[model samples]
Target: MTDPLSALEAAVQALPDDRTLRVRYAELLADAGRHGEAIEQASVVLREAPEDEAAKAVVRRAALAAAEPPGSTPAAAPPDDRHEDIDWSELEASIANPTEPPFVERVVAEHDEELVAEAGETAEDADPVAELRRETVRLADVGGLEVVKRRIDESFLQPMAHPEIAAAFGKKLRGGLLLYGPPGCGKTFLARAIAGELGAHFISVTLSDVLDRFIGESEKNIHRVFRTAREHAPAVLFFDEMDAIGAKRSGNTFSSFRNVVNQILVEMDGVDSQNDGVYVLAATNHPWEVDAALKRPGRFDRMVLVRPPDDDAREAILRVHLRRRPIEGIDLGDLVRRTKGFSGADLEHLVTTAAEKAMTESIRTGSVRPMRMDDMRAALKEVKPSIGPWVQTARNVAEYSNGSGEYDDMVEWLREEKQL
Candidate 1:
């Protein structure tokens, strides 16, 4: 029998410099246990035809071959490593056997669900909603909202569990709670965490999914949101960025949007006093933009403020994001202090950008190690904080915060910092 490596070598020697031939040659080399040569040849092909799917396919195949156990047999390698030659057999087998999807796929899938639910699909159709609802926000992931979480658990979650006891006195179970804060401050994430703690379905709705080009479509979408909630009773309906559809209607604007806002007001009001076991959770960066009628007593009675992370919260954010990364002798407390006024999202980005910078530097210097403090400091120079603009808008809105009025703290913080 002919040796596979010898056959592969002969094949590579026979091939021309054409992109397709090079790709095939690389695949055969990889399958024949010559990964180093395969990688080198694939790299050349990729540099020449960066956008060639066939070339990229060969690179991926070469990578997997290099990763395989030393003694494991290589699978059949395609001549032209294109999508046409994708090992459907392997993919289908994995899907049937059920291994975890790649990390990128998982993240992309989660984001896709988020985008869909935000457009206002029923909770039942949005499977990711259920998954998000199951994600409990550990005190660590929440950053610096200790006081807020304590109040919420004590005031809302605990009370709702024992509604009969509350009713025996004078208190009744509330239908909804609204969380308003600056963008990227973790409002959506907090709502998901709440749903997780409650062991309920998290249905996230947004204006994009509900609003329609056709007349009367918006109202119908609104009905569908509520109707689905009723069907999946005892679920949490989380409306993110509610201002888009729930905005206060100016007398000068088109009546169509005004009517939709009015319909939301009516539905929210209708849900009150009804113990159908459905809980309404809403969040917005622009609370002042919401309709006055919707903020009335019966609609969204309990409003919570989800402000940017304070110093302590920033530390927590840094820790959470850096958990899986390689770090040595890094002072988290110092980072937090230096990153005052940063949001949870900002901290995550800071860590990621720093790691990327370090990786690039390592590649250049032939170093295979985690990023150091100097690399992080360099990234900080490039990644500015996003909270400044948010704090200003929050202050302006706080001045007019009539209902619940919980955003006063955020406003005060901004004022003290002279950022408002």
Candidate 2:
């Protein structure tokens, strides 16, 4: 006689709408220790007929079984059969009202009352610098971009490391450093590495961390960020997307935005030039969009261009992304050669696409398979280099707006790459 579970699986495959068959199959899968498959089967039933008690019970039991640690006997289902793995409350609420939005689309709640550090303190009043952390990544962790690294070392790291030598030579370990490059080129990562090299705490601030809906709140947030860094002396306060926060005052329509920019200018200089130990680092994809005042002397005067990863960096990125996934016969050197001009993010997407293709094949064949070279080749065809438009824009800027020799380095790079 044909095995009952196998027959049911085949039957369900043929008639997928058979709710009764799927529930029974799910139960059998749970009994056989295939809890993941069992939960999937039961979830399908719940989606269609959410009030189905039997399907709900199966899901609860299977989810609980799946959460159990290996080598431990499965515990009996409790009266409520609630499992922490799945949000049962949210699932039931969604089932009750199908019009409700999914969890991903739901808005996160505002900062809670407990986030108030003191009585009568509002959300905006809270210290926005709570995310300060010690960075372990150094320049060595960064694979390529030798030119960018060298610029950082000579300009920032070396001076801080040998302060005595720098003072002797009349070099000040002050002034903001602005890193301009295409997006996902590891500017933020490099900033963190610089902080680590200095053995300082890293505090990264983005647009959301500074911008507020209320008037005067945005400027307050900016002050808070600098104040936090000052309190934690020898800290690196990194602004991830400086263009958004320090947009050109002339271009901004809102007075509030101009005020925010003015506040940033004031804070960067610090009160009585007390910003000795607080290192300010900012990154922007569009340096041309940043306010000219912010880039003036005594501000973000020093600038570095972080271009896309080279061959070695691309290979390192691919290896990192694919380390956990099962892969076969992948030529790292060939991949690196082919992925020229690809950013770190683009390489990660390529790996993800290849893994997804392998997974789809595995699902269709009912057997797990490793990502192969063919999968990677197919993925490469689909995922083109995303840095083309950025490069073109940079080239145009280098050509037209580089009268002051500001973007001379970019001009040199464009000519070197024959993109000019």
Candidate 3:
């Protein structure tokens, strides 16, 4: 005789993609006065299906219920008029034509979904590590970022490739490289390419793979991750969002995460384990937010700035995305010239939007139509560069807080782009 609520919770955990199961579990949680859990479950549903009115109601009601003290009756709340002026039709259209899928979707497509489970919960018995025994994408596959590739070759790839030469030069295969850039700029892709070059196993980890609600479990998870990497020696362990996992420890709000950072530092330094052949790589949009200790010598000591694609890279990205699609009259040169500040992901969205337009026209005409330059031009109107805010933030850091000159690469990029 299992408890119904417990059984339902287990089922939802097992099949997270089942929207109906999630909604029912949320409802039961709300009924049981577990408002906080209800809100979390409902929010996960909303993230996947934004138009789920039932999940939205559960969130609103559970939130209100949580505000009341135990044994106190909740008073009827006033209506929320915050969005009364919003144009419903326009909003719906925007939702339908999303410039890009959510971050969760992008990461899940490339890595393990279990690695991105909701905060403060562990994906029980789930192996989130995605190990690529032989990576198919090499540095040659990367469209641009020649400067980044050269830096990696000099610092990491060459040494790993010619161990005898490295030994003769007294260069130990140690330390990690941090790739910082605007979101959707192919940092993860670059990391995979590095692994391909090294001809090693690739494992990408995110915050969800390490954090857990139980005390001491996070530290244990960090150890487990390193151990797995060591077992597959000649491996590349990439941490996607380093800032969240290794935030500055000075803040009281992040005191709980301090141990996690300390554990990472210990593991990176190989204090209690043999990290001889394991290569560590990390990427973050906010390098300034990462723990300063993690940037110390022999850790993520070297940082590289991966900027938006240049002309050649843009053309290559466009061709790769459109090669299999039904397209015609696509002037790659013109499209590349027009998309000056677009990141790799922005270009992908541009192509996807163009394809969607062609699909819509086909539906209306009852005949398949090839995606044309006009369709691309129309998509361009809706898809703007998503890297502006990040560039502005980088400019602020390079100008005001760069006493150590750690962000010199970013400063040089800002000047080249006339943003300084």
TM-score for each prediction?
Answer: 0.63, 0.71, 0.71
Q: List the residue pairs that clash in candidate 3.
A: none
Give me the displacement of residue 18 in model 3, in angstroms: 18
Please give the lDDT score at residue 230 for candidate 1: 63
Per-residue lDDT of candidate 3, residues 63-176 (tens digit): 556656779986543355554664544433232212232111211342334454643334432344545465778999998878878888887788789888878988776559
* Models ranked on TM-score: 3, 2, 1
lDDT of 1 by residue, 300-391 (tens): 76777776777777877788788898877778777877787777788888999999987887799998678778777887898888867766
Model 2 lDDT tens row, 214-325:
3355677788888888878789999988998898988753444677788889898756557877889999999999999999988998899998998778878999999999
| Winner by lDDT between candidate 2 and candidate 1 | 2
Q: Of the candidates shown, which would achieve the greatest lDDT relative to the real structure?
A: 2
Which candidate leads in TM-score?
Answer: 3
As a whole number from 0 to 100, the lDDT of residue 187 in candidate 3 is 93
